[model samples]
Target: GDDVRVAAFGPNYANEKFTPRCTAVSMGSSNNVQRELCRAKVLLVPTKAEGGPLVAAYAWALGVPVMMHNTGIAASCQECYARLTGDAAADAATALSIVRGADTDPRWQRP
Candidate 1:
């Protein structure tokens, strides 16, 4: 857990508190977004309501694994998506497991 770094991009409408390891990333240019994505080991999109996240596409293109809420394009995709029950604790646990898996799973590894 200490080895993992979490970065939050975009607005935090919920005003959720983050751990010290989590950094709040300001929304910036597309290049800045891409630079962040490039450094990520996995991209986790936990939003329950979304049509299709453009960032997920960018992550895919960069060969980064994605663990997203089961909605929109993530619903159609066969791998790397989870059904969120709207329970914050449960959802966070699920997200953690997904991230851990992505770190070790060969399927999530770039070629």
Candidate 2:
């Protein structure tokens, strides 16, 4: 959580300049960006409204765990996703625990 940070990849977000402290976002090639996601330890999707993004599936295919709250995804997505609530620190802690684990396999197993 503290060590690794989140970045967005989409549209003109690649050119948009955000505050230095803000996470890096690339709105460029989806394929390239997705390929890069493979090395990442966590993928956070904290959107307010989403119609189950395909990226979730892609993450699963690559074996990269996910940390989500608010965003929705297709039924087949097996990425480790959590419903964030209560406190922000709690969510961060949850993500930290997952990231710290050595196993690359996702924790979220939907029934």
Candidate 3:
């Protein structure tokens, strides 16, 4: 949406297509990573396959909500999960809904 700001971290060749809409950042130093994570309202891990992303742990520790693919620790944890339907629009809508819920849901509130 127009109200949402997306910042993507890591190497993505198609980052140019999402320019202005998505700000791409490099996964450099730990300090840099922490800074970026701290600025985020929700950490979205949309990967189809992942061994185990420790960034989710860091986000949780920092009191940030996570909306990840239904894999790895996300399957076991009580965090939000993004469904992959092979339809880009549908998947995006689902992701948006999850993000909106995270923003308003009291369960995601920090102490």
Candidate 4:
């Protein structure tokens, strides 16, 4: 969708194909990564190839809703907002709504 912007935080390899809408940002230190992750409304994990439990775990710890295709790691993320609706647009909307409602959730005390 026109509203969705994807930023890939890593080096761009010659063999990789990145769309125009997706910006390739350089990978940073742990603190920088944490700060960047905290700013996102949703953390889309996409596939097992992208990462494993550690990434999902971090997103959950920070209260960011994670959207990923089925994987053992994805299943392990316990946030109520982490369900994949299977429709990309719908999932994105749900993710944004989850972030908007985060302040109201008693379970999520801001870090």
Against the unseen true structure, what C-alpha lDDT does each candidate score?
A: 0.71, 0.62, 0.68, 0.63
Which candidate do you rate higher for lDDT, 1 or 3?
Answer: 1
* Deviating ranges (above 4 Å) for candidate 3: 20-31, 78-86, 98-104
Residue pairs in collision within model 4: none
Off by over 4 Å in 1: 13-16, 19-31, 80-104
Best-to-worst order by TM-score is 1, 3, 2, 4
Expressed as tens digits, the lDDT of each residue in 34-54 for candidate 2 is: 657766777766665677767
Per-residue alpha-carbon lDDT of candidate 3 for residues 41-90, written as tens digits (9 for 90 to 100):
77777776886788987777776777677777777875443445667778
In TM-score terms, candidate 3 sits at: 0.68
Estimate the TM-score of every prediction.
0.68, 0.64, 0.68, 0.62
Weakest 10 consecutive residues of candidate 2 by summed lDDT = 102-111
Could you tell me how far off, in angstroms, the CA of residue 26 lies in candidate 1 after the best superposition? 5.4
> Which candidate model has the greater TM-score, 3 or 4?
3
Best prediction by lDDT: 1
The per-residue C-alpha lDDT of model 2 at residue 33 equals 61
lDDT tens string, model 1, 3-110? 666777656632646644466566555548777888887777878789988898888777787767788888788674456677888867766776767757655665
- Pick the winner on TM-score between candidates 1 and 2: 1
Q: Which residue pairs does candidate 2 place in steric collision?
A: 9-26, 10-26, 10-27, 11-27, 52-73
